[model samples]
Target: MKNVTIYTGPLCNFCDAAKRLLARNNVEYKEINIATVDGAMDEMITKANGKRTIPQIFFDDNHIGGYDDVRALEKENKLLELLK
Candidate 1:
């Protein structure tokens, strides 16, 4: 499986939702809390192409965007393939 990373912040519903979705699929991920990690917020913004949102996810080196974007991939049946 590809390495999954999620950039998140405190009190974010989208982040929780995204995590639940991944858990349901048995996907393991590294979670980076921007509120607690130094310079993580800036790294997330850069990786997300300037989108300043919580739950910016990446599958390996490829950016999968936020919760809605990742959910869209799941809805379209492409998320698992991407992970593979």
Candidate 2:
């Protein structure tokens, strides 16, 4: 499986949902809480291409955006391919 990373914050339902989706798919991920870490939000923004949002996800080096974006990828049957 490819390495996954999620830049998240507390009290974010989207983040939780994204995590659940990844869990259901058995995609292990590294969760980075920006609220708890200094400079993390800046990194997330940079990685997300200036989209400052919670739950920014990455599969290997691919920025997968937020929960809705993730679900869309799964619906399109591309997520599994990325995981591989």
List the global CA lDDT of all models. 0.94, 0.92
TM-score of each: 0.96, 0.94
Global lDDT for candidate 2?
Answer: 0.92
- Candidate 2, residues 1-84: lDDT per residue as tens digits? 899999999999999999999999888999999999999999899989999989899988888889999999889988889889
Per-residue alpha-carbon lDDT of candidate 1 for residues 1-84, written as tens digits (9 for 90 to 100):
999999999999999999999999889999999999999999999888998988999999889899999899889998899999
In candidate 2, stretches whose alpha carbon ends up further than 4 angstroms from where it belongs are: none
Show pairs that collide, candidate 1.
Answer: none
The TM-score leader among the candidates is: 1
| Model 2 lDDT, residue 34, Cα | 98
